[model samples]
Target: MQATRMISGRAIPWGAKNIDTDIIIPAKWLKTVSRDGLGRGAFESVRAVPGNIFDVPANQGAPILLAGDNFGCGSSREHAAWAMLDMGLQAVIAPSFSDIFSGNAFKNGVLAVTLDEVHIARLMAVAADGAIITIDLENQVVTSDRQDRFAFAIDPFRKMCLMQGLDEIALTLAADDAISVHEARQAEDAPWLVPAQG
Candidate 1:
């Protein structure tokens, strides 16, 4: 996972509430195990409509999405986060998020910012104006070119992992030396517990 200390770009003004995982990436797209190409399926249903916000010309390649309350509320599918990243969304701002989706997003290096409805409205307006918005994870704040600033809270551990680009596998590998030492100690303490040489 790439570290996400800062994200600066136009945001997609999608304030639709109660958007579930199936809506983010339909279940039909879940047949494959690979994360690649999921972007084509991201918001498949929404894009089917004429003149959807996501399909608007100005919203192309936006790195941030401004969503309404309770974003990412549905089945515990990590694909939702993957699809968003593949679609070039580095962060999502909303009034709230489903706990499972938030965890999955964090694991995949996607910044999910939670703010009050007032802040959401302000950001949504800024996004609709095609203004640049910035997410500074280092400072735990979101800012817009319109001089709007909103502070958000995140778990310290999750913040550290994202800033360091440390996924669970990276975190486990970082403790390799300690794990080796423990294994050696166990071998010395109980010979029978150690696997016999082939």
Candidate 2:
């Protein structure tokens, strides 16, 4: 996962509510476990419609998405987060999000920001005008070039993990030295319990 201290860029501004995992990436795209090419499948149904927000040229490769309340509301597929990352969305701004989706987003390094409805509306308007919106995870605030500022809250542990680019694998590897020490001690204390060294 990549470190994400701040994200400043164009936002998709799709303020529709109740966007589920299947809407983000349909089940047909779920056959493969690999995240490669999943971006092409992200919002597959929405993109199929004429002049969808995801198809707008200016919104291409936007790092931030502006969504309405109850975003990512259905299913617990980790692929939803994978698809967003694949599409280069480092953060999502919404009034609220599904608990499962929020967890998945955090684990995959996608910042799921929760703000009040008023902030969402303003951001959507700003996005519609093509203004840049910025999210500062370190400072826990979202800002716009037009002097819009909104603060948000996040778990300190999740913030640290995202800022440090620490995934589960990285977290485990951080204790490598300690693990080695423990194994050595166990072997010494109980030779029969330890496997023979190659």
TM-score of each: 0.86, 0.85
Whole-model lDDT per candidate: 0.91, 0.91
lDDT of 2: 0.91
RMSD of each: 4.4, 5.0
Model 2 lDDT tens row, 1-198: 778899999998899999999999999988996877889899998999988898789899899999988999888998999999998898999999999999999988899999999999999998989989999999999999989999999999999988998777778899999999998998898878856787
Off by over 4 Å in 2: 169-198
Superposition error at 188 for model 2 (Å): 25
Model 1, span 29-101: residue lDDT tens:
9999798889999999899999998888999899999887789998998999999999999899988999999
Clashes of 1: 0
**Backbone collisions counted per model:** 0, 0
